[model samples]
Target chain A: MAHTSNYILGVYDDEDVLLKAIKNVREGGVKIHEVYSPFPVHGIDDVLGYKRSRLTIVAFLFGLLGTSLALTMQFGMMTIDWPMIIGGKDYAPVPSFIPVTFELTVLLASFGMVGTFMIISNLKPWGKAKLFDKRITDDKHIMAIDLGNNQLEESAIDKLLKDSGASEVNKKTL
Target chain B: MIAESAIREPLVTGGKTVHDVTEDISGRVEQKPTKTWMLAMAVSLATLAVGGYAVMRLVWDGIGMWGLNKTVGWAWDITNFVWWVGIGHAGTLISAILLLFRQRWRMSINRAAEAMTIFAVICAAMFPVLHMGRPWLGFYWALPLPNTFGSLWVNFNSPLLWDVFAISTYFSVSLVFWYIGLIPDFATIRDRATNKISAAVYGALSFGWDGAAKTWSRYETVALILAGLATPLVLSVHTIVSFDFATSVIPGWHTTIFPPYFVAGAIFSGFAMVLTLLIITRRVYKLEDYITLQHIELMNIVIIITGSIVGIAYITEFFIAWYSGVEAEQYAFINRATGPYAWAYWSMMTCNVISPQLFWRKKIRTNIAATFVISIIVNIGMWFERFVIIVTSLHRDFLPSSWAMFYPKWADVGVYIFTFGLFFTLFFAFAKFFPVINMAEVKSIVKATGEKKQA
Candidate 1:
């Protein structure tokens, strides 16, 4: 609710129009802070030229860590730490270790990827979201341009947004 | 963009715009409790109270309150355990597997189904812990924690211990997956919240989602990877659960086919449970347009496939038991069909194998009332399936003198009722406080697979 920065937000009703407007606004040499939508507008990232997310790499690394930890824990306990003959099987039964290993791998990978995603995306429980328009979470899509980031005059940027099919353009200090 | 097939039926039937989708889905959450919801909660809470008393008796008076004899030491407890666990599979299958396959129909049902998966697993976990009699100690002992008593670690080689890991991992991971999916939809509710308390609670739950394009891009990637991870996790969960029996020396329990057979049965029962709940939910909530008849038919088809697989597994088990020429194994299958538990076996056959086959008829599968009835029947049959496998196999062991018939005590029935009450209670609360459908996902697909264009 505290106002700190000046901004102009173009409100769009259709996803197709929003996609085109993102392109138009960017081509008009205005820097876009972000585009917000109720749902994931397919190809909006491509139009915005956002790079593909590398969370998968983080997941893979976490999975490897889980695998090794599970192996080491089991092997250390069952084989070296306090070996006891169970069901007359080998003290270190590798095959028997697969189920727990797989479970841990999945557990860590999901938790890791999600944790990394929240940290990077600023989606934290205590964080405050800058709400330019509540309708963005309903039916509207929003293209927010920070006046400080763009070199274009405020009137010229508003004209570009109108020409690009934004239903309305509004300015706010927030 | 890939064009949708011309012949494909529309997934969302109502000509709903984005605003309408949000309103229709979140409308329930924002409203005061309906009379039906109150009545349902009262019934659920009453059941939970009665069951809770029985659980306290069992916990206080020991597991001897149940009719678990020496021979049938694992009767209702294990049967219910496997039954509930199997019932937990369909949610992940719908959300994770169907997503990987690009099945758009799951969009409407996955949220509720995943919710069911978590609740069913909770019910399932209750049995084993309660069956331990001293669950307070058993719970900690089950984990591979370093103990003061000689620093003894849990048996890594035991399937039961593997089960400890599997169930815990499955529960936590499913919860995370469900919560992550709920965040965006929570933001929808949060933004629309008019009351201060409602706004604050939902806002916290939403984690302040801004719906930026880059975040959505990452969100999609994380969802896909989680789906990929969950697919195998679902399959592995049931496989390990089967290992609890398959690794045993019991003639009827030890079979190579148990893994695939149990997995199929899990999906089979899980979908039936989903249908049962959704049919009622859609009726009460009036979400029929989103959960169309087509969704019911498609799920019924899945029931058919998995049900057929389970039927074949039954036949294969008998064939292998006879072909193995082992007297104990042969006697196990014969005793299941012709012995004291023949009633249970045939009920399983009639309900699970024969009943789902009826779905082959288009008329029966498409009828909501029929689907509802059969869905209940399938669940009953599935419960009996586990009963047949566990009690029948254990009752008449090789030592005839030690063999005894297993009978349920009031406590057994009461404890089972407790889970039913608990499941419904949790479900009703979830249906009320949460948006029962994934509004965000449904919105993404509405324009593409909707029966009519946005108004």
Candidate 2:
């Protein structure tokens, strides 16, 4: 039984060096599992060739969903659930629904966006995540590679990281 | 990225490193409050004490404490509510909106704005709490507690209910947003803390953050999510406040434009308050390098746009009333322009609508003295806007017999003072505590801008 294990290959030094190393590794046809950073480096998505975020798509759909829900809830409540004539207006009043509808649309969309953001980001409320380099948040950049390939000799990977300007290289099996 | 960006040019042409940012901002906050902050605090406190006693007396004497009668049921209570609500807007802008836009300049001013938001909301909240007359029953309105009363559903549609929900939501969300951003910086202080008690206090708030890669990423995600949530909530909160008036039967009150008008006014005055604080803070904190003149320039542009929107709203109200040919609406406008509160109306116009135009000059927009004074003017103008709207409208209702001008009794004035004092007291304390700017975020932006920095 081959239980495939993923290893985190850390190339820790600075952004430019890490970027060059990652691109070199990718060009060498290495399949990376993930890259972690302390902060987002601009154009990194293109560098790693990651997919554009689907979060926006989800947000739009959720926003529409919210809008529909708000309009239905508001219109239905005023027009049907417990409609009372106020200020000589009719039982089903559109003008009066403006405030509630506006509020609800905002409420739902904002909530939906937040919920979607958290889910897509894969964040749990508690517990620290595994980190490649602690100092990446301060003054470092890091690239992580999964080291399951037979060709990916640990020495060669470490050599590649150093040659490409990695200040440090670490391999962790998790 | 840091090593790579080491080669990059700095954004502000020439700027300092992360260490410099820390030193500069800490230096800014470290100052003893200027004669100005002290003077303002003293004045606000005195006003509050005097006003607070008057209000207490009124509460004791019953509702007759104010000039409020059958016709003018709402007086300074509503005016103060509107003023405070308008004041709260700049905090949301500085934090949520600016964060979304990735504006680096936000760092210098956001602390003051967040403090302002918390304070202004406190001020706004006092009106409804006390105006309910049976002050103890205030909790009843927040009501339907499981123990005392059954879970009677709040009328989902009532603007008053919406105010309760919106105000509380704004307060809690702002607190979380402000606190979350402060945590890492708090950790920095914790590390630098000499006193054991100070270390413990900051350590608890900092949540053991060590600026690790995973921690920073998590912080960024959380901050973004919170900011995204807050942007619309900020808009909704004020819109709900506007609904308080728009839902009413009064001719001027019943309009579709109220939400946008109120929001614009809120943002306008909010920016003014921010300008006032940032000016003093930048000078006192010696944060001239961080909260640069450029930031003030950007704020001036916002103030002008919102100010213009308010001006348009004023014109649009006149146009709509004339176009609708509603006699009552026309009467409201006529009374506002020419009646007993005509001075208030004109003051609102000159201060809010007219003053923001001075920002067209780059020099004036960036000048701390000019911006500070304009902000104060805008704030005063906005207060009068609410006063004119509430007082003038209520003063002359549809019935001629019910027409009566409001003279804010000592109690009415006192409560307003107490509210401001409460706000300022909280603000002064907040300044004493937290790192007003998100140091981590600013460092990130500094890195992003690829500046050649020196600390």
Candidate 3:
């Protein structure tokens, strides 16, 4: 089931203008649902008041899981399950386990983080994407403000977007 | 005023605006292949044909087609393996390490370099598998798989087994990382597509990237984490590769210095390959303004540093061999420098050590022609380095009765030619199809200093 919503889309020609407009519209007490740009606008997250991502913490936990699994598997195989005397070394050599352990740690951490990111971003293989403007992926920057979240009238928000240097403003419904 | 003047030079030249950047980079992919590209592809395909014939013959015949005797079992096969693997390292360095260090200049070159890593690793992987006599079975046997053979499992202690895990992990992780970086660029391409097929193809590849700020935030975080994972991962890959030799009982192969030495040499050779490829790529594609001389100069500086480290490692190996007071070890070192394989040793020294010293001069480092020649020389030198280590040491071991000369058969030469064919063919296809430069990353850097005028 899809939840329909209304949004006022403001498009900007320049990133500088977009950056400035993000600040101006926010200061004017307008709620921004999302801002989209072709590339990362460095301070946009801070300007839009987004919290720092916890993906790194998740990556750390995943790394620990990888390390534990690798050590357990190696120790069990070399010492517990099949013990063969080779090169006059002990059956369970910790030093020898380092390479595989390290490789698995990296492998898991990378895959886990990407998986976490996909889930959190709602990026499913079969899910339909919400595209605001095709030009956002090319050269334009866009700001989409949800009508349900904003207290101001639609006309007032449209005037505010124009004053804040939006090249064009369009009403979008989904 | 002086300090302000010394503020870093602009990364992208020719005063390119954001729109111009999109046009310059994506246009290359969308445009019809030029006559030069067609000619180059034709030549590469011909080489591929020759290499293909060679590989087919090797598959038909057994490992006996190669001139490996009981004395020198491992030869050009392993040498080419290590050489190609080393060449793959520079790509990871440029893409992951430089990104972690926040070097903006990497933005322009990382895409091609990362592609080189994937292709070079593909070439490197063929040798170990093919050298196994029965590659079809050996591939599975190397893995620690559950099988019907009673109580038979992969030896956990073997460095060769470690290599199976390391190389595969490195390849998969690098592939994912490289593909992740390509998404936004693919989205850009998708939006710019004039035809339906192009749109559908690029659209699927981009995973429907909507350029939402929330998505961009997560994308940045993922890129950072991936870079962090890949930095140590790249170092470990080469270090593990060196263990395949360093853990052995052979005199020259067993050394405390192997890890660092191999890593440095890998970076040295890898940067050289990057330079070789980029020099031609920049010229043929007319990407002068994007991949500028500054990028070449910076990469050359890296070559000089890694080259010097490799040279130091070489000298240290000889000194340690002499100081160990073991006659066999001393003989191995002496033989490497003055024995039948002395020519190879000297070539390694000249190319790896002496040639890169030319970069110490600012003019030579910055000169495109000079950088190109030295890059090829350095790669040749690194190849000889591996050859010297494997062949020279194994040829004359403890038993003089069993000591013998190893020579390359037509199969040995052909397999290597096949890899070259494989690498160039894949690279040309990537160049023609994918965005050679990371357009989004470049756009970020250029936003502040990009050309204002529309190109």
Candidate 4:
């Protein structure tokens, strides 16, 4: 197991500057356990080589579940239980089911996306965020890259950060 | 040579800093009440008093206080519902759709539109939730539970139930979307807040943001995902709303054209509502630097597209009704043209279809006053559009036995009036309290736009 407060290499600048350093670190065959940033740097996912996300597939499946629930509710209500004809229509009206089903489909898809997203991002309520520096949200852009310090030495990361535009570098334990 | 070429525009105006963004937004919150604020408070309060009293009476009494009856059970209430829901469309459309399209001009007005969406939805929900004879038990109709006592399940096939789900989901999602966008800006405010109480309140809502790349990234990711989800719902929501009438076997109401038509109408009116708010709020808040004429022009373009869509839908409705040789449908359209509600029908055409065409003129589109007026006109037209559709369609249905004149009793008009009053009251409060601009996003855009100018 990795040490709780083991040394992690962090870089800070603007997004464009940090993105290049992240690419270089990965290209040097360094395995990154995670990257923490204040904002999403577009196109960084490609550099990280993360695969296309499964959120959409999850959303589609939730939509199917919604469709199933919508159908069963209408079918079971109209046909089997308390069948009553209002407005001189048939007992099992199909077209009328479209609206609710559509609503449920949307609701389920949205809920699924948010739930899966929260899981993947590892965001929890009221936990202290690991801070390299507090100005990360301001003009300063930063990258917190978890270098496998159980294998690599702290000196190598210090050199790597100084080589990049890291105005301030720190050792953080994940 | 390359360096000289690149040094065109500055990223920020010289000496402008993060404090400026906070100060500019919080100006309304901190400053003593100006004459305009006083005037607005007076107007909003008046509107609220009238509207609140109207709603109080509506709630105290049952739905029978309205002009609805056995045949045309949903008249003014439905008109209010559709109009308010339609009004909400532009916010999501402007914010999410424009973000996806990478239209940087959207920065000016997106936040206000979102506020409007939330408020307008609040108004829209009022009629349906409390419109029932037993307003308390109406909750039973909405909750998807096993009904032990009623001995019958709530009809899942109902568009009413669909509406319950749709409106609630729309309200919740829009709030989430709006609040998430404001978080970074709220933090910016929290840091700069004058008092400890203000700082604590703003700080807590800001989720302890430190603008690290991860927070912004995840925030954007959440926003983008929500936007992606919301865009289709913008279309789907109105489509389902249309289904509320269309799913019925009522001759004039039953048609496939409604989904697309309602979607178009919703967007058209939604843009109008946005235009109206942006014009007033821009001037009121002195957001001239942020809400430029260019942003208004882009919104006007959307308005124009949706207006044409509505016009085409109107024509298409007639064509389909006539071409299909459905006698009831034909009579319904004809009656709409030469009916008791003919004035409303014509007004809808004139306001919704004709007035929006002014945007084709560059001068008119850019002029804030003209844009504002036209927005008000579109709003009026859109409300009548619902009225003309609902009243005209039902007042002369297939059976003459069921035909009757539909008019809002005093109480019905009050419900409409008060609901709008509630909406404006909410909006006025929002304007007073919150930073109407998503300051961080605007700063980013301001930076990006400046870069392009330099390039």
The prediction achieving the highest lDDT against the true structure is: 1
Candidate 1 vs candidate 4, lDDT winner: 1
lDDT of 3: 0.89
> Following a full C-alpha superposition, what root-mean-square deviation does model 1 have from the true structure?
1.4
Query: Least lDDT summed over 10 consecutive residues: which range in candidate 3 chain A?
Result: A122-131
Q: Scoring model 3 with DockQ, what do you get? A: 0.57
What is the C-alpha local distance difference test score of each model? 0.93, 0.71, 0.89, 0.74
The number of clashing residue pairs in each candidate reads: 0, 7, 2, 16
The digit string of per-residue lDDT tens for model 2 on B1-455 reads: 43334553333334666556555554434445667667767876776777788778867777788778787888788889989988998897788998899666676577678878878988888888888777886776653232245434334457787687678767777776776667656655655566787667766665555443333444455567668878988988888899889888897788899999999999999998888877776666566666776778889999999999999999999899889999999989988999988999999999988899999888889787888899999999999988887888888977898888787777777787788778776776666566666566666566556345456
Candidate with maximal TM-score: 1
Candidate RMSDs in Å, in order, are 1.4, 5.5, 2.2, 4.5
Off by over 4 Å in 3: A1-3, A124-128, B1-6, B451-455
Across B249-365, the per-residue lDDT of candidate 3 in tens digits comes to 899998989999999999999999999999999998899988998899999999999999999999999999999998888999999999999999999999999999999999999
Which fraction of the native contacts appears in each prediction? 0.77, 0.09, 0.60, 0.27
For residues B282-337, what per-residue lDDT tens digits would candidate 1 score against the true structure?
99999998999999999999999999999999999999999999999999999999
Q: List the residue pairs that clash in candidate 3.
A: B15-B451, B16-B451
TM-score between model 2 and native: 0.79
Fraction of true interface contacts that also occur in model 3: 0.60
Model 2 chain B scores worst on lDDT over the 10 consecutive residues at: B144-153
Candidate 1 Cα errors over 4 Å, as ranges: A1-3, B1-3, B453-455
Total backbone clashes of model 2?
7
